[model samples]
Target: MTEMRLTPLQYMERVAAHFGTAPHAVFVSTFGCQQNEADSERLCGMAHAMGYADAATEEEADLILINTCAIREHAELKVLSYLGTLKALKEKKPALLVGVCGCMPAQGHRVEQLKKSYPYVSFTLDPASLDKLPEVICTLLEGGRRRFVTGEENPPIAEGLPCARRVRHKAWVSIMYGCNNFCSYCIVPYVRGRERSRASGDILREVETLVADGCHDITLLGQNVNSYRGDCDFAALMEKIACLPGDFRLRFMTSHPKDVSDRLISVMAEHGDKIAPHFHLPLQSGSNDILARMNRRYTRERYLTTVGKLRAAMPHIALSTDIIVGFPGETEEDFNATLQVIEHVEFDMIYSFLYSPRKGTPAATMEAQVDAAARAARMERLLAVQNDIALRLATPYVDRTVRVLADARGKQEGILAGRTDTNRLVYFAAPEEMIGQFAYVKITRAEPFALRGELINPK
Candidate 1:
């Protein structure tokens, strides 16, 4: 007999038959970057189509979907640790369906381990195969067997997937997928496959929809976002989105230094009103030799030059970056160079991480691997230096008035939180109704991590 392929409606019917008229709940535990978060929205959207409602907690979920990350060893370890806790839940509720998805399932070894050790997991689907989720769920329900569904070798872009965004006023739109720059220590390219940019028309339509739906902030996502090339380049695509009439600010991330072209900078400079004056260009290492070893494809001087161009174009642009403390064979001189760049840039924020060797990456097998303790110690020193810089940068925001989009409720009672266009977090006392609207806030005080402000205008 030939295998069957079902439409989304058929899948929903199958799901409905399995659970009957009783309500079913799904809990999605997402791990990793914004891209993963965006992917989870679609996962939940698929669950909704398959007749499942959102579950408040894992214990209450009829189906549990763990969206795994594979960027670092530490993240993978955390996923495994979390999965251990679910085994008991699986035993208690034998009817519960458990699935693992995302980058972790894309790896061959991880799938094998899940099959052998994690028998309770009903299915494992890779990120690119997300559209096939309902199909996998249907298979498990009908065939009564675990399923392993990997994405296509060179996956075609899946457009028009419904997204149930977690935040109503903020949204993530992936303009592109995957990475072309391998960067010896990175595994994104291998798991996510080659780069594929969504057509400009598709992206423009998505952004227009979001803005019309009252989204206040929109972020374009990709592993190497600046490298996007579809009907138009990344720069041209930004221009199109910026031209769209809306009361929203745009942001993008994980730009490779080499891809931050003058044209892109010029476009951003011209459209400062539409684009957020915040840039997140990663400077993995500041030492030329380390950068070469990492295959980052840009020299330290080139990286600095890009930053210079950005600063020259937008004087008040907030700069943030990602830094890895120790890579294979990093010397004290190299580490110092990174510190010097940090001090020189005076970034608004820094996401620093200690090097963790990932299996199958070139750096994992490279000679002169830095000691674990040494990496940890270096990370501590790096944090201290960045904290001081962050504090200094934040201090300037005090007594300054900024327009903020109140996106969340603050930790304290009767407080609302929002971020400035520069992506600085600000907290102020405001009404609950102000959560999704723009507000003028006068900065009262500043902390290294956030600013405390008083609401100047309610709306």
Candidate 2:
């Protein structure tokens, strides 16, 4: 089947003529991972193409979108609280179009909760129905069009839509969508459906355009990139991107340990710095029992083997991971095992979370749910252990010279910060002209999270 494509102004004209009005302003509040951020960019781009200018604030917006997440109960509750606050605003401005989108609204269970509990919300759209955003927005704006466009037929691969990307320098390109690994803790597979890879030609073209558009870094976003199957596999795609005509960096994330292959590591090793020296291999729980329960499909030993192979391939690779502190039926012994794994791994970064049960997941109904207070304590201990390891790992950067790509300005007084090839955040004093370029910095200070450095003339 052929896809329908439209230029930015073409859609803008269609919306303008349909509504018989001038341009509108839009405001989108996004949550969750980089994939959601990237999806929001496309949403904003679609709005702009339909003659919608981004509002400075939600109060001034003609359309307000709540691009939400449901990974944890906390994430969902945050969105719910925000929606409660917006009810008065929706009352005051009846024409103010408000809708919920992304993973939360797409869940089959959340439909009634949105419709009954938050009736002020005019409509809902899933990530898959984003291509129909103009139609949805126009209908809702016309009044008495409250509905949900979710869990419907959603094709995985979407191309050629204009985007109002949040980060100009670092482009997020989705190589594939959905997750095949039904990790018991995750709702991604249920909401996002199964894995579907985009054509390699489509991905390469997107990268080429972003580079031409002055993007200095390209981050490939996927639930599980290692499972990507197209004209090329994940490793081949990375190699092709590394070979592309550009001086920019290439990075991907959230690789399932079970699917990550030697070929992928070899490709990164061969390409070296071009493909980045950072690998985010999530080790959810160190205990073999917990791993079996979570359906992660990999034992602690297997995960360590992958880490060893990665380090062997590229010794300087800065490692990062996702960890769950208090899983269902987790004992003190299991928690200690997790800490031991963290101590042994010495990851440069850890994205830790206290597991929150999601409705319709197997683990939610599982017996022996850990106490909230216990979870908090476990979380604190896990963080303390990980923080100490991170600090030690970062210490080597001190008195070393590293190349950093300036991505943004630092929070410190007149400081500029960027990231190294190993995904290390380095802050240094530099001119604003270096915002989107590479520069060498002499590391002077090393913290658990970031490195403080001084600018050095590139060698």
Candidate 3:
């Protein structure tokens, strides 16, 4: 049987008749950042509304969609590998349909290549067009030929969309979409398009909904969260949210140092008790020349000053950072500068990656190259220094009583895991009933990755 494609409106008309009495099942495998996860929720909601049921496994799915990421070379490679596996499955189940969406499909060349190489892939859609998913799926189900819908139309927030959430207590609320900052090595600005903040009313409504659903923590997700300038802007949004009627904690991520204003810092200081005191500021490079080349728009001195200010306001702030090693034209001197910054800052955690060329970016076309061996050596040295610092920073927490919100069960029996306000992972023995509530725990042992603790008072 040939595949058919139908528009969203068309899909709605034929949904009941096409499925007959049987439910159409869909399986979504999401990869990459929290933004992708939030996008997948809407994707699933669209599928459900189109008379499709959620499948337990890919093999059981009548339709499969891979929400992919293209931030690093490895992420792209993994998507390709998954496609190969799906291709083999398609041979066995000829009626099954597969699709690719999200950041990878936003790239024209990648979409073209997928259409050419994987004829089995029924369609490709961009993240911004996800609300039109029912129409896209309808087109495929109606026996239309393989096609791509890389449309530029931004979809409105599918408010009240149904979701099969992967987590129960913690929910990711997307305050905005896309990125305006085009860092030299990044592909986000090109693929995700320019930044557009969601309306403040919409964001507040979402957070209130999550809290009502018993969600205890909300992480506002974005590429440059501090750059959010909806009607309330970032600082005002944080202040308003902190005052919401709930014992829930608020958190956000991936702040750009250049945009971390004093007003925002003051908001954090005022609501330090309600807001998680953890910041993940990406310091791509420590050398001013390297930062300039990467177009990060912030000097090492400026970054250090911001860190100093944050520490002054919140002394026990748990600082996490992102570092990129082996960027194009990075000299040994430049790499050493990063080490010096790491030493001086003493971050609690670091997400380090070797620079990978991304298509359609200025850095990709640059001529300078670091040898593979040298890059590996530099990464190993960087990790060693970071690990040593992480251990030193974690040791001081031992023997202190900290309030923790239990998130999940631990790997061992009778063990439960939770996070402190600063986002430290603490595992302690507690009953299943206490999993979603707050408890005061005494840290008995400390490790670089997690802390061992016990419930000081069980209610």
Each model's TM-score? 0.96, 0.94, 0.93
Q: Sorted on TM-score, highest at the top, how do the candidates line up?
A: 1, 2, 3
Clashes of each: 0, 0, 10
Candidate 1 collision pairs: none
Colliding pairs, model 3: 3-143, 3-144, 4-142, 4-143, 4-144, 5-139, 5-144, 6-138, 6-139, 8-135
lDDT of each: 0.90, 0.86, 0.85
Q: Against the true structure, whose lDDT is highest?
A: 1
**Candidate 1: residue 207 lDDT (0-100):** 94
Residue by residue across 176-210, what tens digits does model 3's lDDT show? 88888899999888778777788888889888888
Give the Cα-based TM-score of candidate 2 against the true structure. 0.94
If both were scored by lDDT, which would come out higher, candidate 1 or candidate 2? 1
Tens digits of per-residue lDDT for model 2 on 388-407? 88888899899999989888
Q: Which of candidates 1 and 3 is the stronger one according to TM-score?
A: 1
